[model samples]
Target: MKKGRIILIDDDRDHLRAASDWLTVNGFEVLSFDRADDAFKAIIDQPPDLVLTDLRMPGVDGMTLLSSVVRKCPGLPVILLTAHGDVSLAVEALKRGGEDFIEKPYDAERLVGVLSKAIEKSRMSQEIGRLQRLVVQQDKEVGSIIGDSTAIRSLRQRIAALAQVDIDVLIIGETGTGKELVAQALHYQSHRAPAPFVAINCSALPESIFESEVFGHVKGAFTGALSERQGKFEHATGGTIFLDEIEAMPLPFQAKILRVLQERVVERLGENRLRPVDVRIVAAAKTDLSAEIAAGRFREDLFYRLASVDVRIPPVRERAEDIEQLFRHFASLAARRYGRPEPQVPPSLVVRLLQQEWRGNVREVKARAERFALGLDEEQPQQSAFSIEAPLPERVSHYEARLILAALGINHGNTAQTAADLGIPVRTLNEKIKRYGLRYSGET
Candidate 1:
């Protein structure tokens, strides 16, 4: 391995010689300079991997040299050396972009360790910048969307055409079908692209706070309401509000939303004044709202208002042709995320990926790809002990039940801890336990 080159700058000749000799003996190429000007000149001639400089020096102090090195060779790592009482100045040096700081009479081993870590970090940063540029180029060449399936092609065309319109849009798709990505493409390709593109998930919030969350509320609207809040609609004014899982919104909230859509105005909770909000509504739903409306669960008028322009995204299973492209994209992303050399997907893995039902859609596929990159998905499948396989819904239910049981076990049968771990309310977990007939072994 090639040894890293280091430049040391200090007015103390004995200290420079001692540090330089120590580093050189440890298999580093060290250059020592008593003046900051000479060190900067040497750096300009040939930049070193790292620079160690003292905080105080006669003409052209360490801080001035640090600034010059950063401006000339921004990638170089610089470590500051300071006396015990000058620790504050060393900290200020770090704030000014010094890689790290070491106190005078520092431990030899600790100084070397810090230098090694800083050099490694600098190299990693360079590699990441290079990879990011490549990704940007690839994105430009293939457009923002990563697939070439007929469904995706049609969706892109529809998005392009819809970008010219100012009408409200409703995107219907199962979870993880990239509905938010589609919404982003629409906004970026539209006239409102320069403005804010805010998003919120209707189902992520409870019904009790839904009104104040969707529409702004004044101070003292309710208990614990200490300050006035600008809701999603007000924040998204002059841009777009992408409401995900809109079908999960309560009927009363749906009625209020319908009035907002019709009148282009909203009234803050606990306030009589009405505020006009100019925002294009782009709503998403995991299920068909028409059926929900027929079942009296959703407001018909709100459905019509939101569905003025509708886009249905096909699930990953329906767009099999796009599987290979998506797999490659996700694999690359995972490799970059894990700081590993990009791995190749075997032909067998590709075939298996295409054949899978992918019930969870693109999100599931990406997750599996990440696991594969991490070598966690390399286990061979063993034959089951049972002869019959369960149906999809039955298998899902069985998995859910087992998960809840495991969480309960980990929490030592504490329902509150289990519910918190599972990210569900205690009441909901209790209901599920009762519905599934799950019992604590200790109780019996």
Candidate 2:
């Protein structure tokens, strides 16, 4: 590896030659200028890693050069050279903008030490700036994958670990389980986060256009190929391409995807030249891929190529403990979206929220929360008492059970208090509690 470049300037012909030669021998790329004007132009064009200037010169002396470098390249280091008698001038220059000063007849070892230390500091500062920007950008993307459950936390950690590696990822989950959110997390947290994140839904694309949609096409390749175009692979170079619902892709197209992953190259529909692409693959599926392979709907070889890492997202039913919290969070969001007052979650509603089977996972709960936030769940005049998923008799039973349990818990299992809360007699409330076989706050 080559050391950083150094710019050396002095009016002394021999001093310039000596300093340049010494730094070059010490593994630096040295540019020497007998006149400060020439060095100033070089610095303006492209600032070197370090600047070495003489304190006294005919025109554009060390102090002037140091001031100019400070303004142009704010963090750059400029070392001043001075005679032993001119030590005060060197000290003044250091206050103005000089990094350090070296007296005449300087030792080569000391000069090398000062220059190396300054260069290392500059490199460290640049690296810190890069990392700070990356953190701010990643925070926006990571905040969307919400949930404090163990499954969610573990999924975030795995996504972060996989993002750092250059491997294909297969995200498996049911519909509405936030598969797309997982994919975005992987792309935004990876080294390719700064690059474009292109997504395509395999199930939405048709067989007639799959080739052109994915791999681009040359002009006149087909009836609608009026102009040459780049495909998702070419567009996502140095980034990630999210292939959602990969199992929905036809078998023939699966063969093409396998080739792209294996070769890291693609060709336009009418072009013979293969274009090289550098992109990470993130595929998602809602079905059992192994079962699909057995049924001959999916290719085993393609699955292996894409599943270099597998990320399975658990359904909301498995995370039932998080339901109340998830519903409250979504309710707040719905209120913000509609510019309305956020509704308080009644205890009765909270009890019903916990009893849901959550077949649609987080998405379904969020929709129901929005209805509650808008006061449409209970108070809408045209709404039916029974949801389409349940019969009226079953829905009535569920409502009664949830209301009795909520009232019992809220009233500390006092029959009189529970009856008052439900607008019923104490005897009737007790009989209904027994009929439902319910337990509450004070139940043994």
Candidate 3:
């Protein structure tokens, strides 16, 4: 493998040819020129790993070339070479952003070593800059999907990988599982990030205007078509079009979508000319598309086309351990948005939260958190009715239940630990839990 690409500039033809030949032999790709001006132009046009130029030249000398490179392409390495190697001249070169100074009649091995070091350093700097930009972009794009569960981690990894390759992707998840959010992440992370991200709800659009809305219509295409309008596909050109709830699209329109996807072109309703489109299609489905296809509600061919890549999102229950963190995250956001202090969620309340089934997934959790933050849950007096108006025996039972629930919450539903903390036997606690109809994690 080549060590690095070098732009060698020297007025001395003999020295230039000899150095180029030796460097080439030593696994360096060399572009040798006798004029500094020509070499500077090449550096600007197609940058090399390192620039090796004579300090003394007839026109557009090495000092001028070095200054131009430092001003325009900062961080690029430029090494000055001269037969008249003065200490002051070398110091000046260093001050002017030159990488290093070498006396001409240079030692071949030392020259190769210096060039390699500069190239490696430059490459490292470029790599670090690239990685920093990538980290910021990833955080901005995929950071919205908050969770540390293995499933979420894997989903993020898949999103990151899929974002690099522009292709049609089908995101499969239950309702309120953030399929559209995933599609947005894919669009923002891909090369088409700067372009428009047009999202359309397939189920929301009526069949009568589906084609015109998606493929566009020319001026006077119909009674209401007074102006030339760009459709969703045209608006999303050079970017992505997210078709949410794609399974709900009628079967007849599925054939039209299939044609657009296959041909990468669209014909407006009143126009005969077909305009080519450049877009990455990302479709989402809440239902099992295979079942839809089997029931003849969706086209099998369109399913195959959209499902070039399938990304399945795990429901909230699947990542139950993330519930507490997710709840807190949402509560904090709600607090900020409402300009209210964040509520402190007690351990017992969290236990009750974990007990209920979140049928709506993250969306349900967010709604609950918002209500909690706004103190709406506290307004439900009947919900928290531990009656003091009842008899002593009833009051005592309610107090006992509250203590046990709190203990269980603190111990994270460990019955044995709750029993120990409450100074009761495990069997006694189990009987009480059964009698009171209390929920606990370890109950089998």
Candidate 4:
């Protein structure tokens, strides 16, 4: 398979041909051009993974080409081929946003290695940027379905479609995977937005008071029924009633719920009349209702009634691309809640987070972000890098600088290796080193 695409520009036809052959042999798809102008046009038309050009051409020299490319395509790598005596000129090119310079008669292996690293670095930066932008754009949308991962986008589309149908929905997901949020999304997006959305925790409700709480009771219905009251179903008339943890619902109550779902009406405990309730039912469960049915803990008929339309939420691990965005959003909200300016998240922290299992899914991420916003590192609570009393942004910067310093030390001051280990681009690492006035052994 071709490793990547490369645009090779050289005024010398022989040199361009030889370089193209070498690169193609190394598994790169080469787009060779002898004119810088043609190469520039090609780059504009379709950007390549990397650009390799001779520094001193007759028209639109490599320096000029490099400038144009940097202006048009911000992160495209441009490596210039320089003659032996033009080391000073090459250094000047580096300052002008050129990625690197290759000495004349360069080793093929060294050139290939440089191009490979550049390509990988560019890819990483672009992916990070794309995910961050996705988080921002989706957060601005309605109903708190915040992510741009394929799983999440598909989930949102499914929710939107279900919202318009005005039918009962069954949402199954792992614990803390936002099943309730899905239920609410369905309710608010439906025609019942003008009415109440009552949520009931089936697992938390006691069986002794289930009837009084769900179907309601009139005066003198029970010992505590001193006055007439509306039950959850009655209160949610013309809206929705969310039954959360439906798998945990008592078996006997499941039949009653199924009866209500089937009949779309409820009878008060003291009355012989059947009251019509025009409310939608949205039930959520973290476990498989089929398994519950097999175990005889849940009623199969109720399961079928509730699952006319089912939605399964993807776990955090299944949509790992959304981790950074989710973490950032949570941190921002936590900061606002705590009356603190949002901390600047370090790239190192993000790298660490993406590697986590996040067994609690979004709930776990939100909790972690709250802790980070409070300037608390749960991993190393005893070894505090900065005081919690300090300004949050300042503390975050200090934490970021410390992480960079440690990574640099671990990589023996090799910026490229340090960047790879920290899961950031070498360019970003170098910028941070300069910003924090850090000393290192191998600068590049």
TM-score per candidate? 0.56, 0.55, 0.55, 0.55
Better of 1 and 2 by lDDT: 2
Model 2 spans > 4 angstroms off: 1-143, 379-444
Which regions of candidate 4 fall more than 4 Å away from where they truly are? Answer: 1-143, 378-444
Q: Cα lDDT of all candidates, in order?
A: 0.83, 0.84, 0.86, 0.86
Which prediction has the highest lDDT against the true structure? 4
Candidate 1 error regions (>4 Å): 1-143, 379-444
Candidate with more favorable, higher TM-score: 1 or 2:
1
Q: What are the runs in model 3 whose C-alpha is more than 4 Å off? A: 1-143, 378-444
lDDT of 1 by residue, 1-444 (tens): 535889999999998899999999877899999999999999999998899999899999999999998889987899999999998888888877899889878899998789888888888888988988686556445446768888999999999999889989999999889898888888878999877889988888898888898897999999988889988899888888898889888887888888889999999999999999999889999877878988999988888889889999999988999988887787666556445467677788888887899888988887777555544456313232223476777766665775676566446589999999999999999999998888655221
Instruction: Point out the higher-scoring one by TM-score: 1 or 4.
Output: 1
Candidate 2: the clashing residue pairs are none
Model 4 over residues 21-138: C-alpha lDDT tens digits? 9999999999999999999999999999999999999978999999999989999999999999999999999998999999998998999999888888988888988987676455
- The Cα error of candidate 4 at residue 360, in Å, is 0.7
- Candidate 3, 139-181: lDDT as tens digits: 4643498899999999999999999998899999998888988
Judged by TM-score, which candidate is best? 1
Model 3, residue 246: C-alpha shift (Å): 0.3
Per-candidate RMSD vs. true structure? 13.0, 20.0, 18.8, 23.9
